[model samples]
Target: MDTTEADESIKYTVLDNLLVDGKEPGSWGTFITRSEMYTQAAQMNGLISYLAIYIGFVLVVACAAILSIQQLSNVADGSRSYRVLAQIGCDDRQIRHSVMAQQAVFFLFPLAVGLAHSFVALKVIIELVSIFGNMSIGGTVSLTCAIFLAACGGYFLVTYLMSTGMVRAAIAIRYSE
Candidate 1:
């Protein structure tokens, strides 16, 4: 007999013979075919993978937004400092460069720390997963890094541009008076 017939035969035999408290096996427990089990596993894996991707995307966007807001607030508070630098013979280019450098450090320090942490976590994950089978995540890591870098770079650029505008406006207001 083919596998399907064999499976059905076995299933029927088990259901007929296996009894708990004078009831069929279906009443007390669950019964599923092998194919059903595999299908359920696949569906669960897909759901977990999608959730992970979505969470990662949300975190990246949230991090960028928080950093941008913090940087903008600092610029607002330090408007007087930029004005002082301007009055003390620093050109607009020098002032802008100083703001850019400060922001670069501010943004990069957290990123460096996060990357180091991620590397350590990834190493642990790889070790654990290797027990099951050989798995390669090099391409996934590269793609993730590329996407992360692009997102962060875009945020950094926007933050820098906004900060420069604020600085310029602050200086202009002082001069206009």
Candidate 2:
């Protein structure tokens, strides 16, 4: 038989098998063409990719917020120390620089550790996936890293600004009193 005839025969054969015993075969099984299967797989992959991106966003935001709040609270508790530094001839620039340094440590340490762990995990994932097929994730990794770093940098800048403001306010209160 020609290819067209063979293809029609296979289609009919699948339909016939599915309708066996005339019981509707609803609970027995179902038929799926190769293309249909591939389509479903692609849809699932898209869903999973979206979910991962969403979860990553939530995690990055949560980490940044938590660190920001923690650092702000520390500044609040240490307001008197800042006031003393200002009284002891430290300039505003110096005080702000101090706050910036502290904020950098608080923000970057956890990020560094997380990145290290992620690298190890990704190495393992690459090894496993390589067994199935050759894969190149360089562009995806670079894009994700760039986005993540931008978010972190934004959060860091905001936190530093807020901390400096709090420090200045504390010093002002000291001087006014």
Candidate 3:
């Protein structure tokens, strides 16, 4: 059946009435209509999207926490190195810049890997979705990318701030000793 020829509004109204009357397959032992099937499919898609977003947020936060802890530990362990750099005429600004750069690489590596995986997975998902209909996924994909980037940027900012403070304190302690 051609979707263009199908009267969706009428079908929606009929389906709505059927749902209101509790005449669905389990409710009244009636066969499910195409309209009802589409409704269920859309609802499931929404649920999955929400679940994915929540999981992505959790992963981003966890990544940031892990990176922050690692950076702080490295600063403590490498305090002697920073003192050596200071002794060699490296200013505090230079030391801070080096620390920030190192943290940036640490934060970006996992994000880059995750994005690579997402690109491949999204390509497969788009192909699978296209089998059902000629839907345009470009907007959805762009939005998802933007959201992920924003989360990553936020985490990077926080990690950089925390690590910078830790590095400064470590350097000061090393110099005092």
CA lDDT of every candidate = 0.85, 0.84, 0.77
What are the candidates' C-alpha RMSDs? 2.9, 3.4, 6.0
Worst 10 residues of 3 by lDDT: 24-33
lDDT of 1 by residue, 1-177 (tens): 987677777777888789899886888986666766767876885697578767987898899889999999999999999999999999999999999998999889988898898889877866764564365655666687678878888999999999999999999988998
- Across 47-140, the per-residue lDDT of candidate 3 in tens digits comes to 9878987898788777777777787788778777887887788898998899888988898888899889989999988888777756667677
* lDDT for residue 61 in candidate 2, whole number 0-100: 87
Candidate 2 lDDT trough over 10 residues, lowest sum: 129-138
Q: Report the lDDT tens digits of candidate 2 across residue range 34-150.
A: 556667976886697679867997899899999999999999999999999998999999999899999999999999998898889877876775575365665666687788889
Model 1, C-alpha of 109: deviation from truth (Å)? 1.2
TM-score of 1: 0.79
Better of 1 and 3 by lDDT: 1
* Candidate 1 Cα deviation (angstroms), residue 91: 2.2
The global Cα lDDT (0 to 1) of model 2 is 0.84
TM-score-superior candidate, 1 or 3: 1
Task: List ranges where model 3 is wrong by over 4 Å.
Answer: 1-28, 173-177
